[model samples]
Target: MEFSGKLFIFLLLPLLQISTCDAYANPIYHACSKNFTSDNLIQDSINKTLSSLLAKTSLDSFGISSFGDGFFTIFGLSQCRGNLTVDQCAPCITKATEEIRTLCPNSAETRIWYDHCFLHYGTTKFFGEPDTSFTRVFSSGLIAADPIKFNYELMDLVYRMNAMTVGIDEKFSMYATHVSKNLSIFATAQCTRDLEELACRQCLDKLSEIFSGSCKYHLDCYVLSSSCVLRYAVSEFLNLPVSLSPLVFAAGFLAAGINSNLTGGHGFLPRSKADVMLNQLPEKSGSPENRELTAGHLSTWPVIGGLNHFVLVKFISGGLTAG
Candidate 1:
């Protein structure tokens, strides 16, 4: 028994270390502009702008700045999730800066989203502006056994979170609720610190409309907009530790079968009419309209991008797998 315990400790130590170090390593999505820059001066400006943004991560979770002058100037922004501490947030931003530079070496603009942080840079000044132009949405394809009740509880939780954002300094909030005897929902809503409260609310409301209309029945879904993000899952995905009551713990065991079935794969649904039209329009054309009609709801995929291209990822997994 002593020997077995020693061996288990040796094996488990490395795995725990790896998980802790790489908790925020995987990026959810990245967007690169089709436009490329061959000019060395512009490239150098972008490099400096990103480096500055990375340095700012040491002080605060949010940073936005413009570097250089004239046509060669570059603008950049980097932000870690509001809940993260400086130690947690800085590494994510550092990883993002490195990955984005490698992924879009010559693109004039880029945006990368990770579970804990996001980075965006461009030639144009977008510091305080709210841009909902690009969005990447992920859905856990698992359907709830009680779709109507689950959705109702989810909307209530999300709306309550939204309200929390209004008074918070960081424009971020999280909320959770037990949706059923055997299931619970955890959710978060956040806007980039640069956005005004009203702008944040509008951006989230737009994304919430998508959730209510299309992703209503999903067991988990997260929508990331250029200006704000909203996410919910059947399992807790936040970095914060949660202590469950005895009743909640019992419910989790009862939902074992549903969680087991969630260990599946992913598939891309057909694009929505809004996405199709957005693709056809000039990059500057109108945003997606709120078309929440009652029929064919499954076909109503939300517009995922405006100026740049984005992927719509649907994950069918055993738990909240947004990372």
Candidate 2:
């Protein structure tokens, strides 16, 4: 018994350490999976899981695969920095997906995003709005070496981007731009179209509270979340086309918040006509996919690129309000 206990701790300690340290080690990723364990004899679980995974996988760009039989669909995706070639995107996503899964196998659902790819899954209860569940928090981990300069720049950039982000859809939305700085400091904002602009704004407002004193500008740090993703990479995070005068892939048409319609509740609000013209589009880059804020309704996702010493109000519990 004593030997077993000792061995268990010896093994568990390293695993815990790895989980804490390995999270921010990557730069890009994509992750998606279904609910329920991969091996459930239950017929219903098998059917639903397979269907959801197939719906996404067979969908052109997301042509992923399931590991188990028709019942289980184990899938993960990623994109390289738009500047990177398809070859680079492959490795970035592959490595991140494998590593993230190893880190949180018990999570059922986990998404570890990086500058290169995104890895996600749906094994546990990650569907719908986690409100506090799928939300993400980021910090600088360092007190602005110069508080005054940091505060001035950070606040200015955040507000400027926010102001520019209003009214327009993601196509023209500009979140933050870092000029004459070490890194291009190009940051952008994205919100799932389902949330009313106000609701989306509120989510960002709450996320701001997590910054506490960390939002000090002047550094390479930013907050990114599902409902709203914000970044300040000190570099041009958005990439231009690789081919000659080729097209750019904007995040996609953001739904102009849902209006009850001119008929008081009859007609639908105007969305990206692109939503209707899916067939016309060739690639999956700008398809109308998902538009939910959090995975389970209120929770947040794990965060990357932040200062070491920071605090997060249990997901959505904090009295943070941009609303």
Please report, in order, the local distance difference test score of every candidate based on alpha carbons.
0.62, 0.35
TM-score (C-alpha) between model 2 and the true structure: 0.44
* Candidate 1 Cα RMSD after full superposition onto the native fold (Å): 18.8
For each of the candidates, the C-alpha root-mean-square deviation to the true structure, in angstroms, is 18.8, 15.8
The lDDT leader among the candidates is: 1
Q: In candidate 2, what are the lDDT values of residues 49-135, reduced to their tens digit?
A: 334433442332122223433434343222222223344445545565457546554344455666543444443332223132344
> lDDT tens string, model 1, 1-323?
00011101011112212243565677777878746548888888888998899898758988987777898899998898766677778889989999987888888788898888889888888866767767656776678998889888887667656755543456766555677667777677888888877777788888888789657788878777778888877766653223332110001111221122211122111233223422333322221231122112324424322201112322222222221
Q: Number of clashes in every candidate structure?
A: 1, 56
Top candidate when judged by TM-score against the true structure: 1
| Model 1 weakest lDDT span, ten residues long | 1-10
lDDT, residue 241, model 2: 14
Show where candidate 2 strays beyond 4 Å. Answer: 1-101, 117-146, 163-185, 192-194, 239-323
Looking at model 2, which ten-residue stretch has the lowest summed lDDT?
1-10
